[model samples]
Each structure stands twice: as C-alpha cells, then as structure tokens.
Target: MTFDLRPWQLADFPAYQALITAPAIATAIGIDAKSTVSQQQAFENDLYQTYQAAILIDGVPQGSIVAYQRANELGEPLVNEADIAYFLSPAFWGHGIMTDVITAFIAQLPPHFTLWADVLADNIGSLRVLEKVGFTNHGTYIDLFGRQIIQFHLYR
Candidate 1:
C-alpha cells in the first residue's frame, strides 16, 4: 500500500472529523473532547503551534501525523523540543503504515532539533513504533493526567 503525506487543508476536515471521532481511534489517540467541533478547534490551534499533515493511503485520509512544540500535561507549550504524535484508523492498524509514516516524517525533520514522544507503558504498539523509528526511551514519568508515560527522545 502506498502512503502519502500532504499539508492538511480545510477540504480534509470532513475526513478528519470522521477519523478522530471513531470510538476505537478516539480512545487510543486520547482525544477526550466530547464534541467534534471542540476537537477541530483544538486541532486548528495545534496546527497554529506546529506542523501537521494528513496521512493518506491512495489519496484517502486514513490518519494524521503531527510534530509540534512540546506541551505539558496542563497544555502549556514548551519551545525548542518537537513532540511527535500520530494515529491511524483501526482499519489501518497492523499494516505497518504508521511505522512507515513516522520514519518518513523523521527523515524530513531538521537534524539539529530534538524530537520527543511519550507513550503509555501499556501501549506496546506505540512503543514498538517509536523504537522502530530510532527513538530511545528516556524515562517514565507521571503525566498531568496521572498516567504513567514512557518518554522517548531522538537527539540529533
């Protein structure tokens, strides 16, 4: 399967709205907002703060990937560090699409910047993907939400 990354546009909103609201995808991706409208607003804010792209397979939006300024548990932004996050539709899981997506994204990053990611310890799949893309586990810490998160970083 071919994967493409493109600048997220207003035209992609319908697909994005549908993808993030799927119960399985929402739970795994941790979008706790109750309404799609709020989620889209937050999404727009995130785009303002960082870079984001749509993950399309054969021109259909299947997921999204973003690299943005690090945010604390309470949503305070931290500069200098790029925090990467991605979510694929449940229909696309287990296909190595995310692994490929992340690898490609990493390749395009500025080598001088440090990249960071936090994964829940129980999120084995996510951890695997991070490792596969050359991220080293830094440490584990409790997040603002009170969940244990395994921190990973790639320092260039």
Candidate 2:
C-alpha cells in the first residue's frame, strides 16, 4: 500500500464536500459552514493556490491537509514555518492514514525545520494526534469560534 500525497485538484470537490458535511467529523475539526456547490468549487480552485496535499490511498483521493500560516505569535521566528488545518472522513480515521500522510509531507516539503498545529483545548483526540506525531503544546487560544484551543508545534 503506497500512501502518497497528491496535489489538490478541482475534481476533488465532491469528495471534500462530502467530508466537510459529515457532522461528527466537522464539529470536531472546526466550524463547518454548510457550503454550496459554487462555494465548494471556489474552495477547490483556491486551494490550488497554496501548498496542500490530497491524502491518496494507492492514488485514490481519501482526504486533504491544508498548510497555511503566518509567523507564530507565541514562538520564535522560523521562516517557512506554518500553521495547518486539515481533515479526513470519519471512515478514514485511525487507520494510520493521517500519521503516514503528515510524516511524508513534513519530510519532503521545504519548511525543513518548523511546523505547528492548533486544536480546540477540549479536543483530546486531535491533541493526541498532534502529540503522537511530535507536536507539543505552545499555549491556548481562549476561544476559537467560542471554544478554547491549545496550540502545538514541532520545531528545531
């Protein structure tokens, strides 16, 4: 099973749209404003403008991880470092799916030394994922969309 990270494409809209609407997953990931097809189209189009990856299982798109960010407010300056937000279908959860996907991206991508992620403070599952993958807590955002979040990072 070769798990590779593919570039995001407009054709990924339907699968992504479906993932975004799954309530259990969406709520846990973050606020999901029910998006229209046009909105979804615009999103798929927009992501092409960034450094993103489609988590492909043997070349079939399973999920996506988006990398975007500014310099961290709570940490030292590290160029090419970024904050990321991403998701996969609940069906794809716990299959060592994201673990493999993230590790590969971090290795091949240009930001060789710095990476960070933030999750709601109450989101234990997400916190675990980040920690298991080597990110540590920086601090917390009192309310990101009305829920407090703990920031995590991997830096050298």
Candidate 3:
C-alpha cells in the first residue's frame, strides 16, 4: 500500500503514543521519552526545529520517519549520514509496509552517501526490514536496555 508522510504535530502524540504501545515496535523504537502531554508538546515544537517527518499513509498515522542534522568530532564535518528510525503497528509487521514507507522516505532526503539505523539487538523483524531494503550490518551500540545491539548502514 502507498503511504504518505507528513510533518508530525503535537496532536500526533496520541497516535504516536499508540504506535509506541505496539509490543513489537516498542521493543525497538523506544517508549515515550516524554512522559507527559506538556513534554509531548515540547517535543513537537522541537521536532520541527531539529527533525523532519515523513509519515506513512493518509489519516492512518501508521508510522513516521525522522531526520536531523548533527555535528561530529575529529574536525571533519559530514553533511550526510541520516539516522532513520521508524515503526509500524504489530498487525502490519512482515507485510513490507516499512519497505514501501522507507523507499518513499529515502527519496525525500537529499542525496547522501549513506543511511543509518540503530536497531535493538532483539528486534529481528526490523533488522530484516532494513536488510531487505539493502542495508548492511555495521556495528553495535549499548542501547537503553543496556545490551549491545547492531547498527545498519545503507550506502547510496
């Protein structure tokens, strides 16, 4: 199915929260960093300033793609290296919904050398999605769960 991505709004929190509640997704995309409505509003306000959204499907709020710019050390600045994070309702898992959404989402970003994602070690389904989309396993990180998890990168 074709999905349309939109800018995430404060009102979208209810839908986003609902998305995070999905067992499979929550295990990866993380639970609310903002635990209150006021916090959600704060995140929404900051979202636009720091991030861009490419949401999936009209009226469904099925998922979102967030992009942001960050600086690095060692003096060499990188304009690329977009870090992507996404999730879908458990019901949509294994249906290639994310594969479609990602295809659409990547096209929206400026041409860059690579796309990166940090997936929870246990989120096998997400890893498969990225791999199916041509991402290669890169390295690992100590995520919130306090365990090392693999990271993926897809070069364009």
lDDT of all predictions, in order shown?
A: 0.81, 0.70, 0.70
Q: Model 2 Cα displacement at 100 (Å)?
A: 1.5
Instruction: Give the Cα RMSD of candidate 2.
Output: 3.6
Lowest summed lDDT across 10 adjacent residues in model 1 is found at: 42-51
Query: Candidate 3 on 69-135: residue-level lDDT in tens?
Result: 4447874546876677776777667777888777777777777657778888777788888898899
CA deviation > 4 Å runs, candidate 1: 71-80
For candidate 1, give the lDDT of residue 34.
72
Best by lDDT: 1
Better of 1 and 3 by lDDT: 1
Cα lDDT of model 1 by residue, 1-156, tens digit:
779988788777788878888887676667764787777885675456447788999889888888888767998876557888888888888888888999887777766878988888888888999998889999999877777899899876
User: Against the hidden reference, what TM-scores do the models get?
Assistant: 0.86, 0.79, 0.79
Candidate whose TM-score is highest: 1
Error of 2 at 121 (Å): 2.5
- The lDDT-based order of candidates, best leading, equals 1, 2, 3
